[model samples]
Target: MNEPAAPAAPETLEVPVAALRPSLEAVLMVADQPLDSVSLASVVGHPVETVVAALQLLAEEYDEQDRGFELRHVAGGWRYYTREAYAAVVEQLVLEGQQARLTQAALETLAVVAYQQPVSRARVSAVRGVNVDGVMRTLLTRGLVQEAGQDAETGANLYRTTRYFLERIGVSSLDELPELAPYLPEMDDLEDELERVGGLPRTPDAVQDHPAVEPMTDSQETP
Candidate 1:
């Protein structure tokens, strides 16, 4: 009686294994955002404690090696960013002539995109309590925001902050944005999102006279 080889042990059981630090680096390299230790552990099939230790060790190694990029923690996760010492070169190479600072409205929209990414334009507008169509268009044109994909339920295109957003902001990850980040609503809660945006300083026309809205500089660097 041949038992068909136990169905090859089912596909889900197979897990990829590799050296810890390299594995972490490989995943972080392509990640659009930082990854928490447990998340990294799951991907690398290691214990969370071991992954955390490895991340610290790797950070030390980069510091010793004077690597152009370094492993960093931000936005409640681990990710990589170019070392600040090299920021000048990277800015020259990557940024070049593109120099337009973010407007208060754009900055608000970007913040919304950062916190509630993979979010829809309608959702963003609903949160901002204004027609964000024009602001979103500006974000798209500026390359600070990108299309993440479509929502399964709504089929509306979802937006996420781009790597350029991280770069310009000089953050290793979204976690580095600031401590206030924890206050942002979780990405899935629409009612909370609406309430969250509604809580922001409103002017009957959403974008005016808001405290978070900083004055745009004269140069207008395309941040």
Candidate 2:
């Protein structure tokens, strides 16, 4: 009849607009790690410059409002952190929960990993005088430790503390770890123990004496 009314003009294709700032907040609220601006721009459907300016504005607003948490640029991305004034409150709560949740053995095993990183579970067991397979698994599950690499000789997986580990302990780098680290078994001592236990010897330079990458300082605390 009337040329089918010209296909009804496609109904204007209404697309609901998402509010920029609230959208940014929603995405950041659930992020476990810092998110870079470019990644954020893609997710929020905004230009990179716009997204970055919005983030800076939000951070400033939070600071002006004296919010309990603040947005910070760290580790090449943006993340939220507890306000410095309220850190002790958060720290006490976190520490109390940690005390109840992590067992004495788990704590001990974690300490071993933190100080003797790039070490194997077998080496941990050798130092603790007990099998650490189960405890090491728990640490890995909690995101406190990660696999570094495999032993060149024995082919066993080496373990190390994660950046998250440094964050929890309020340290920026492994060098900030307490003096007790020196008191732990040295690499040579551990190697000798491995030899006694019938494990193959590792090359002199197979594992690094320090963390391969120093963890960046988080917003709230530092060593």
Candidate 3:
């Protein structure tokens, strides 16, 4: 007697190109990163040109509808982002929502990272006058801050604010960040804290003397 026939592989669903908008929306809604047309085409099992056109149509529809969310092709891929006009309302909702409330420490740490980035943890702690490891972890979990790389001399991990942070704060670029002089800790305070903290370089000149990866400017940064 022969063994039972092996189970057949599950059939892949072919999303019809003509009807791909909703399917694309559903996947893009759940995606953690921007998706390019080629990747989306593979997912929908359609031709690249067809998927590209479908994505463009969906984007245009969202624009025409003036929806709270819009599909955008950014950083060479497609993703759903909150419409800029409604950012303030979304921010309020997220902030008021129990799970999204960022503590004062986290906020301070985030600000330091935002302004001083590709900055190291020691530098951040120095600026905040407290150990920032925990706060950094929280920011990382929230997708607000990411490790850029290591410091050249000290080899400490360098962190930078993410585009998500800019979106949450409703800024197109760091230049759009509100007058940093008022909201962020004073330079004197950072210097004093750096003195007390006594680990990372004590001044900008020192930090600049040696560097690892180049810091990304808002223009160069991907969302």
Q: lDDT (0-100) at residue 183 of candidate 3?
A: 62
lDDT of 3: 0.74
- Name the runs in model 1 displaced over 4 angstroms: 1-18, 97-157, 160-223
Per-prediction TM-score to the true structure, in the order listed: 0.42, 0.42, 0.45
**Candidate 2 regions off by >4 Å?**
1-18, 102-223
lDDT of 1 by residue, 1-223 (tens): 8666555554442222337767888899878578998899999888887788788878888999999999899999998999999988987865543575667877887887888787877666656656566677777767788898987866777899988889988987887767654775554463444445544433334332222212222333322
Q: By TM-score, how accurate is candidate 1?
A: 0.42
Q: lDDT per prediction?
A: 0.71, 0.73, 0.74
Which number leads on lDDT?
3
Sequence-dependent TM-score of model 2: 0.42
* Candidate number achieving the greatest TM-score relative to the actual structure: 3
Give residue 130's lDDT in candidate 3 (0 to 100). Answer: 67
True-vs-predicted CA distance for residue 134, candidate 1, Å: 25
Models ranked on lDDT: 3, 2, 1
Candidate 1 achieves a global lDDT of 0.71
Give the Å error, residue 18, model 3.
61
The residue pairs that clash in candidate 2, if any, are none
